[model samples]
Target: MPRPNVWRDSAETTRLWVFDALAGFPLILMLLHLRWWTFGVAVTCFVVFGVLERMGYSVRFALRRLRAIAGGSVKLGQPWWGKRQERL
Candidate 1:
């Protein structure tokens, strides 16, 4: 049987994947409407956006962890470390 943690991880990964895909949809269409060289520039911008998004996700996850720790919820799932706590 799949663990609850596996499900959570899958959901988070899928959500991120969908978000990136949705955000890139318009850029992809615009690139298709432009010249091939312009598509290269679009690709570069897409890469930059992806990097920034990843960094932001990491920072937000860290902040959430810090807040949880401060609130005495250390026993909860550590989403940043991809660890799930066993129910006691």
Candidate 2:
């Protein structure tokens, strides 16, 4: 059977955020030591990234999508990458 969606499960989503927080904590701390304003920026960036992750968005995926669009390979309402006959 196909597995249930992780985002649909509250426990799984919470776990995902927790791990993200753990990974971001050190970066946030470093920013705080550098400057108070930097700390705020770091926290804001982390939160934005966290929300995007929760929404199933990936920066790498977006970059590839943009590349595909620039390459004139992808059309509107279609995937930018995957099983392509031509190289991107």
Candidate 3:
């Protein structure tokens, strides 16, 4: 699924919520019909799963930036930390 522009950064935005709802609708309904407690647990699992995923992405991004710096690849924020972006 494509990430829409408006909801790219927010977890509670209507677009993101709606997309998650539609994607999980069948599983949600099935779990809810099976057992109330199980349905609650499943919803919690899905929401927190995304939180963990976002956290991991951020860590990976930082590591990538550090690796680039160490390799002397210049970037806007770290221009002083490495060689300038250039062509011979």
Candidate 4:
């Protein structure tokens, strides 16, 4: 059984709700408590998560193209946070 595309998958839909809850819960709390600090924290956290999610999608897109180029044979690359940083 092959996996479905992200757009057609329940997993992605569930993730969307989870992410929304992460940001929305903080927002609602901030509003109810009238805390300006939480507003800042919530906005910052939301932005960070948004950036991370975009990075994840970008990496997946890149890997998909690479798999197509390699005839569906794909190998994982070294972790970006590995001990030794590459000198590009």
Top lDDT prediction, candidate number: 4
Pick the winner on TM-score between candidates 2 and 4: 4
Candidate 2 global lDDT: 0.62
Give the alpha carbon lDDT tens digit for every residue of 20-53 in model 2: 5443654657665898776776767667666766
Tens digits of per-residue lDDT for model 3, 1-88: 9776995577653333423433354456756589877677667656654564466533234447669889785555655658677788
lDDT of 1 by residue, 1-88 (tens): 9556655566443333534543465477766688777677667756765675677754245447769878894564557567666798
Best by TM-score: 4
Q: Which stretches of candidate 4 lie over 4 Å from their true place?
A: 1-9, 14-19, 57-88
**What C-alpha lDDT values do all the predictions have?**
0.60, 0.62, 0.56, 0.63
Tens digits of per-residue lDDT for model 4 on 1-88?
A: 9886776655442344546444455667778887779889778866766675666643245446767898756766788687686698
lDDT of model 1, residue 56: 73
Off by over 4 Å in 2: 1-33, 62-88
Task: Put the candidates in lDDT order, highest first.
Answer: 4, 2, 1, 3
Candidate 3 similarity to native, TM-score? 0.29
- Candidate 2 has a TM-score of 0.37
Worst 10-residue lDDT window for candidate 3 reads 13-22
Better of 1 and 2 by TM-score: 2
Q: TM-scores for all candidates?
A: 0.33, 0.37, 0.29, 0.41
Q: By descending TM-score, how would the candidates be arranged?
A: 4, 2, 1, 3
TM-score for predicted model 1 compared with the true structure? 0.33
At residue 31, give the lDDT of candidate 4: 80
After superposing all C-alphas onto the true structure, candidate 2 shows an RMSD in angstroms of 10.1
